[model samples]
Target: MTAPTLTETLPARETARSWWGDAWLVMTRELTPTLRDPFSVVFGLVQPLVFLGLFGPLLAGSVGATVPGGDVWAWFVPGILVMTTLFGTSTTGANLLFEMQTGAHERLLVTPLARSAQLVGRAGKEMAPVVAQSLLVVLVMLPFGFAPHPLGVLAGLVLLAVFGVGVGSLSYALAIAVRQQDWMFWAVQQTLLFPLLILSGMLLPLETGPRWMQVAADANPLRYVVDAERALFAGDLASATVAWGAVAAALTAALGLVVGVRTLSRSTR
Candidate 1:
């Protein structure tokens, strides 16, 4: 039997197709070019990979001694993953800004796809590349003695995507909201980027910081994500860090997409 049409599956009062399918369409549309471009993958990961190679080992012994597992690479991987997502996804909306200026976004807005689908799909497409970044980082670290369990490695990749989706959605929403304001983008991007990394203990342990700094880091969502990643990378699936990170991911994704959908809708109007 043939699959039911989207309209048939919905109540008679509803006319729109399935948001899931629309999302898939959008995701596939964006992901196709990425898949075809080998260099884009390398370009996206160069900074993180460089940090992993050049700067990471200087403190590897010290950081490893500080961590419970005594594995500096494992401790550091989580922060790098979060950093990877933050630095990578922060610019996703720049393309949208260009599209808006050129009236491309207005055209896309008029299409029959659901607004949620469009936003979700773009975020979804980003997942593949983000996962690829994780793999690349891990492989590069392997020769340096980082050996996370295979299942934990898989879990870490999933969390990286979750974190990426939240950040990417916010990037697109902000880009749409601040259309053509190049300075605002740079200002906010620079301000948000390093603070998140520094405050979250991606470079050092939050616990080792001053009392005020540790307290402040506790409030940063990315800290939870990095902590979760550290746990997962260390083969500790039952860690509370994992739960908190997932919660932050869920909340971030929900907030970002809601605002993004609304912004996309207003832009179209």
Candidate 2:
């Protein structure tokens, strides 16, 4: 005739144990608000599509000349796809800052959730919009003759998801570091993201950039990503391009997650 105490029924430290489960919990928490507002998701797609639509065709002829036998849409779609992930993941830190300021993060800290899982879950969930944008980009571009091979498209999505995790984690780390300073968060994100995009050879051919720019691009990890994406988009999978790109993306994700976890844990402490 014994009754279980509240503590026995609900162990605070045992609330979340599995890393993947904790991550999934965090992801769902982040996803609900965004899902409720469908417009926000759709709204984010407009600018990228606009670029794909207006920018793709307009620069196709000029950029196509750079490739040996360029199909205008072929040359441009991959870069646009990369840009979609970039734009989508660049704001990862902002919303976290909102949660921090609202003391939502403090509530999370009291839970048994792993600190890294917080970032992993949030960043991992961002794949939704990124993949959606990828699909939309392909669907929209398909009509205009952007004929990406099936496997290539699948590989490209993987590339984007990997890259998005990296970028999103970086944003979270930066955001946590600057949680009290909203202005600095925005400034740093905008400052770093656009420059990285430009240097990645997304909008133009890397070979054609100025000497210094080409040198800079050579060192940029994103260059590998774009190159891989471009090759995949063109259905050329039998090359080192995808391998190199995967390595770069994996490196970026690893570094970002490590940094993000450490930063968030320290901030909580």
Candidate 3:
């Protein structure tokens, strides 16, 4: 029998770095479609600006700087950042659903890439836009006097990214499980958006709500992200609650990644 070719004979080292490299390639390729699409690229930047410009002033009085150590805009800034990340991350599932429906995903599966790599790549691509949105929120907040400690701001940004990754991975799984794109959109909006928005300290401070809401907020991962952002922007170092929140958010993302990889594996089969 002929010996295997050199390319085929070499051991496939599926290390973390290799997986990350594959994911980076996938992310780069995936980003082209998003960048080329004018609406998506524009909306990603514009939506948050509109929200901040319109709602920031309108709600400023109602959520005035009297409630706690932080000002109204400081609290609002973090929530807006979360909202921006959500919009960017949640829509990623639709792109995956489109690819799955069009057989693009199948084409990718024929390669030597591991299923986890594919999932991570797709997820990493989705996170790119969220990162952009988070940055934009920080820029917008700077003018409004929302300034967190340097380290705190960095931690908050990291947490936001982690939260988005977890949420996006979960949404991607749901998108694949469903048959149609519209249903995926609806489900994400209804199930993921409202709960995270309401329960998290996004629209309002968790302390301002009822006892049950406070408990629910404590359990919500997004709450930690919002808190981290709020604490950072408000320069409330002593009150910073993001260390535990970051740990929780990272754990959640890791779990979501595992679940997403399993789901993708099964679906491809």
- Residue-level lDDT of model 2, residues 1-269, one tens digit each, is 89988767987766536999899999998889888987777788788878876777677656667753467677678888888788778787888888788888889988888887888998888888888778877887777767888999998999899989988999889988887777899898888888889999888777777899998888889889998998887788878988899999999989888998889888752
In model 3, where is the ten-residue run with the lowest total lDDT? 10-19
Clash pairs, model 1 backbone: none
The per-model lDDT (C-alpha) reads 0.82, 0.84, 0.73
lDDT of 2: 0.84
Give candidate 1's error at residue 134 in angstroms.
0.4
Candidate 3: tens digits of C-alpha lDDT, residues 1-269:
99888767766763334777878777788788778884665567677778778877776777666445646776787778877777677667777777777888788888877778888887777666776667756776687787656776666677778877877787777777784545756665576678877897677666777998888787877777777677765666556376766776788789779888888888752
lDDT of model 2 at residue 124? 88
In model 2, what is the error at residue 220, expressed in angstroms?
Answer: 0.6
> RMSD for each model, in Å, please?
4.7, 2.4, 3.6
The backbone clash count of each candidate, in order, is 0, 0, 2
lDDT ranking, best first: 2, 1, 3
The lDDT, on a scale of 0 to 1, for candidate 3 is 0.73
The residue pairs found clashing in candidate 2 are none
